[model samples]
Target: MKSISFPFLYLCTLTAASSVASGNHGLYDVRPFTISLSDGVPRMLERIRDTELPDAISQYPGNEAGISLETLKAFRNQWLVDFDWFKEEESLNRYHHFTAKIENLDVHFIHEKSNEPDAIPLILYHGWPGSFLEFIPLIKKLTQKAKTSTGKHVSFDVIVPSLPGFAFSSAPGANWTVDDSARVFNTLMTKVLGYKAYAVHGTDWGTGVAWGQFDGFNTSARAAHFAMLPFLPLTPEQLEAQNITLNAPLEQFEEQRYVDWSATGSGYFIEEGSKPNDIGLVLYDNPMGQLVWIGEKYIEWSDPKAGTSPSVLTHNEILRIISLYYLTKSILTSGYIYFQNPLGQTGFRYNYTRARTDAPMLFSAFKYNVHYWPRALAETVGNLVLYRNHDFGGHFPGLDNPPALIEDIREIGSYWE
Candidate 1:
């Protein structure tokens, strides 16, 4: 693999300063900011907890369908009684946080540095119904020196950004695509933070942003890693043309996954991509609606075995995830991401011509993920370097299986030469 020239990435870094007037320049006034609850937000939330949630829960008892009413009530009760948002905020604020003006919007991110001079810079992007909070658990692990499989100690200066239209960050104006996010994020790393060359990892919508950095800004985005790839698996016709074959077990698993997703999992995609605003309006102020919509995915998409386990996200963890959306009143803006980059009814139809990246890319395939792409098909999108398959874990691997994900990331960082 070719490397970025030192002149392109590092020459400007030494001289770059924060604060540029209306341009993709260095981050200005990057200071510590707390996650303050919006005005009237606490009162509204209390009203919902004391009155609305119980009425909603009582109206639909015994789980006819959707989020189990009993389970939701239990979660709501814990959120009201036990879960302390202030305490959690304090824990979240333990890491360094900052906001940068890029593309006329303030992008919020956590920049945790490693003491090791040789540490590589790695930016992590989170996807829809997810936030930078997803990457919080991995911050300490990634920033500290860790022993890789090859017994080499590696550390990273980690940056986790709240994507535009997500918590704390400014939303895009109109028709904002993932490419726009990629461009701004590239600016964040090179122009703002003065890191000429850095690695990136993403999941869900984040994969699109990661691909954007890899393809649109290759000079600055040195290497890429993905739990989710830019493109989907090949069709039977394409698979046959390539003369690639899958064994009985692999074929069965792929077939079942496709069947299951097509039958049940595709509704959210269609609704969000087509009429995002319509749904957004309905759920904007309705905290229960927002919780049911987003929280259901949190439960359904995760590893079935990860029941109230810290190894995976706990009940409080899941509640905090939804609460962030509610508190920010960003549920509407956040859903617009799907409309901006519509995957459409038929999945895997992304324009492959545009899926070009020269940077070396690594993919870690978690078995229980929503979509599964064979290694052969995944290589067509980028300069494929490493692909590893894990026995356990699902969609949100950063939170679901931090140890394995961190190890895989460290292994890829070893190939930075």
Candidate 2:
């Protein structure tokens, strides 16, 4: 085996954080080492079929957004039959792809740079119930906008990586957490992609990973930003140690997260965080199950208070995300990631006393979710270069409101430049 010197290894470590953060994005001059997906995806599907669902219908807690006879038939007819993985695969494969062996597991990512080489690099992370597919439309906007906004003289290099046990990547071999996933992403940027500086934006689970990556990462990853910073109701322990109280103004952000956690998260949390393999086996097998499970996020993540009768996350976008997970057969492995994940540091940052990063953050949230009212909390955190609140959208804004999402990205890209 070849050996790397101290200085060289250190350089790679530092550059990793600043580089474009996904697979097959043309960040590396050398081709990404390929990994196997054929055997894994099919096996997952078979397992999903073998597992059985209860005779009684299962629906969301409290509000039963029951699938009507008509809707059920439609889902079974179209999603079960006509949903085409081949076409989606072809569309996704148009971008450069890369794979590399990291910690004895295969990692998959999309790494694409525009015509301009020095363009600022942006890494987009996907949360649970979604895959790299969520960023497809945004990738088009960011890459194209960077050029036009910059007079075609420069552009943005985009990296979108599937987290460990997601899509083409292998599940954790032993105990893992969001932080471990963050470490792998950091390694991809430095060791494989040869980048020393960059920025990251994540939603859902990706946001957790991004938080941890920036928390302890000993590199120049610039700054980390997220949509959901769910810290509600100062825990008893936090009170004991810090003597902090959740006053009227302080409780707004934390209270809502706790309310949602109690109301909607009971089932999803128990299954994914604990007995994942049981139901995950079924999701892996049945495409119908895949769609339902992945599609549930729209209802789950979208604030029920949005006033809109239906979720702002359009059906086409919802289907697109579910299709990726279903086609990849990553349902089981993705769930396994949650199982292996434990709170190395409680997963709850709870660091209100300390400023996270000096880098400016562009926190664009909607009034529907807790992200809406963060002005007070924003003051407690690091410098908020821009915090815009919209009356629409929810957890996944890109899917909820693509136009506004695009505008935010373009504006931030220009601001940072």
Q: Which candidate leads in TM-score?
A: 1
Judged by whole-model lDDT over C-alpha atoms, candidate 2 comes out at: 0.59
TM-score of 1: 0.86
Best by lDDT: 1
Q: Show where candidate 2 strays beyond 4 Å.
A: 1-70, 145-154, 230-261, 303-316, 343-346, 349-356, 369-373, 414-417
Write candidate 1's Cα lDDT for 1-417 as tens digits: 011224334234323421111223323434344566746358646755655544455665654457887777787788778877777777876666666667778788888777777788899999978998889878888888877677777889888999999988989998788888998888788877778788999998898898888877888788888998766555556676877666657454654565566678768878988898899998887777777898888777677665434355778888788878878778999988888775632222454543455668888877667777667767777778888876566778887778778888887666775
Candidate 1: Cα lDDT at 264: 81
Cα error, candidate 2, residue 355 (Å): 4.8
RMSD versus native structure for model 2:
7.5
Model 1 is weakest, by summed lDDT over 10 consecutive residues, at 17-26
